[model samples]
Target: MAPSIQSLSMIHDSQECIKPIPAFSCCYLLRSCVRHASLYIGSTPDPARRLAQHNGDRYGAAKRTLRENLRPWEMVAIVSGFTSRVAALQFEWAWQNTKVSRHADLDGNATQELGVRICPRTAKEVKRVAKPRTSLTNILANLHLLLRSPYFSKWPIEVRFFSADVHRVWQVWLQRVDGLLNDGIRVVTDFAPDGISEVEGKELLAGAGRVGTLDVGYNSIKEYVEKSQFLLEDGERINCGVCKQRLILQHDIIAVCSHSSCHCAAHLSCLSSHFLKDKDSDSELVPREGTCPTCYSKLEWLTMMKEISLRLRGQAEVNRLFGRRQRAGTPKGQGLKSVRGRGHSEDENESDALQVSTGLDTVNLPPCSDGPWTIDCAIGVLGGIAHRPGGVSSGNDSDATVTPEIETHPQRCRRNQNTRTQRLGLQKSAMINLSDWYDAEVIE
Candidate 1:
């Protein structure tokens, strides 16, 4: 329409001062959030206007987009602030072809840093390892991005993370969540390392049209870092069909198509993009119509999604909750002392309580632990063994008596000593007999 526009496109004249219109600029991703999960990318002057065109409001919509008949599309992301329409288009081109751009200003790292994702048609990886948002560096970077947005000035966003409760967050159960709140879609966001269902969940929840503000980040798994690994054998081979990387981890989303003849296995996200590309059905409602890349077998999305979800639910769930951890039991060979531990009785010593509980009241307890009422020590003092004049006799002092004349008479003394010794020996013999009798009675 203008001389400058014409010169930029067709005119041979290269003028330094002549600039194209800088007002037109925007790049967007049109993605099916819920069922189809198709992604389309392009640049436009007005996103809303271009969206209407894509929907066939003006002319026929894109053949690929309309072929799938899933209506009510939502703009997933829009990147603006380019200097001109040409710049925006170039950006789109860069996004679509990361290695093809010949422009001097464009770089692969820059494009990648801007969140321009490339879904490979072939394999080189198992799963796309996403960084955790809880990392300090990532948290600060996300914070910077959040602070840059103008929406936060008016309506603030709050992120709340819940610790893993072994039952819900870590285990796979078939029980259905009975009721859902009618007001808004309450999503369980487990953003862990890989974002919860990636971008699909966020877009779905946002498009729910709830009146109140919504938190789009992963809601279920941020509070904990489940440092777990694969439960499979080392001999088993697993690789992502898209990235071609080894799918060695349990956390990896491995999706396998069971077509009997063509059992094609791939990472879930990798197969998702492939599913869209290989889809034969023109209707989006007729899901799971894609062909397996390896076997050409028809891929049913419902079956694939079900299998993937079930596996992902099972993968490392038990490990996250009840996997190998240090046992809470007391260490081996070391005796358990209950009194020192918390909430123990302050009135009695723990050792005393232990001895009492084990049926080893006073006699069996070692020295420095004997109770004040122990019969062995009390009887020792009363029998003159502990209070002996010269020194305490090592044994048989319970019957011997001290007298002025009794010590002079050797025969009398010997008889008294023998009697004392006999009496002490009898007492010990009687004690053993009584114990045996009690044991025999109990056995009977």
Candidate 2:
């Protein structure tokens, strides 16, 4: 029987409700080709589509970029690695209003001076301070300052420059900047081929041609999630590698070792705390990298987080991983709805909902003990220093095996009060707005 129009609408709504949200957000820089001085800064989950919207090829473009005079726009660069869309938006707002933002002062005066005293300013005095002009120089300077700010310094952020001219300016500014960017933050240059004309660049930016090549440093979420699926399927009780406590699949957020041979598993909080111990700063909620407890392999915290994101929110991937096929006659929306309603779920649908409802599930795991192997020790072993009963020895008996020195320098840590709480908050907020980026159909 043919379904009614009302029935079709209901099914569509149901499908939209269950759509999986991607955990990605980035702040982008756009310049008006017509007027080189005119620039715009915005944030979005998808940069390519956002660029198209600004060029009048799609809907939902900001009023500022809609004028015929500024008909075409070019993306200069993008800053990614924000923990959430909210984080990216906060950054966007700060970048747009740098002069008044509390982050403007480099001396820590603004943050510390707040609530100490409020000297009233006259209308004339207020009017005397001109608004900071938005130029390429000022924009890059503010970006440098914001990245160094204590609030954002610890984040594993990466800056990618798509324009060769802009990248040269950035390089010059970095030398002039007072302080250096955090070691964890990466600066990438993905400029188009030399001798490419302005029109060619525009075509690339408009999605008609490939722009610059992106050098992805870590494993993608799909590959990471698929490889780690055995942890859920093995049926053996999994325990936290740090705390040595059994991991409850439905209750605790889990992180697995990225190394293919290693099967280390732990509560997200437990792993985070374990990684933070190596640094001088304990106030941080995220660690850039740490040695695995089981295999002693170095693991990137950002990579693990990406895998966790897929496990938590990627419904289609999860279904495929578990071999959960829909019944032949069932509607797609109905099939997804049924998959979500099962209790003690294999798909983690219930747990994801619970995490959304509550801020985050706090797991009270015991403090991590010192690991038997350190990263230095692992390096030494890989360098042909074999471990004997007492200590490590070199390849030759006559040669002395110098002990590998552990890193003592205090590395900066990414600070946030709560780990899981903020992560879950990101997931919840991102899921709600997933449709905004995904549902739109680009004209080109």
Q: What global local distance difference test value does model 2 have?
A: 0.60
User: 240 in model 1: Cα distance from truth in Å?
Assistant: 63
Task: Tell me how many clashing residue pairs each candidate has.
Answer: 14, 0
lDDT of 2 by residue, 31-146 (tens): 78777567899998777778778888789899899998876888888998887678899999988877678876746423222212111221111223222454566677788888
Residue lDDT tens for model 1, 1-444: 112334333322422233433333556656543332455667776655566666555564566567435654555444554544566676566555433444322232332253422122221222443332211122222322322333221111122121111113111111221222221112132222335554544443234322112222111221211211222234467666566777644344456665644434676666766766565535433234477778777765544553333233433332333332333332354323322212322222122221111111112211222221112211232122121122233454333322111002122223234444533433343312122112111000
Error of 1 at 257 (Å): 63
Worst 10 residues of 2 by lDDT: 354-363
Q: State which candidate has the highest TM-score.
A: 2
Instruction: Give the 10-residue window scoring lowest on summed lDDT in candidate 1.
Output: 435-444
Task: Give residue 363's lDDT in candidate 1 (0 to 100).
Answer: 25
**What's the distance in Å from true for residue 172, model 2?**
1.3
**Roughly what TM-score does model 2 have, to 2 decimal places?**
0.60
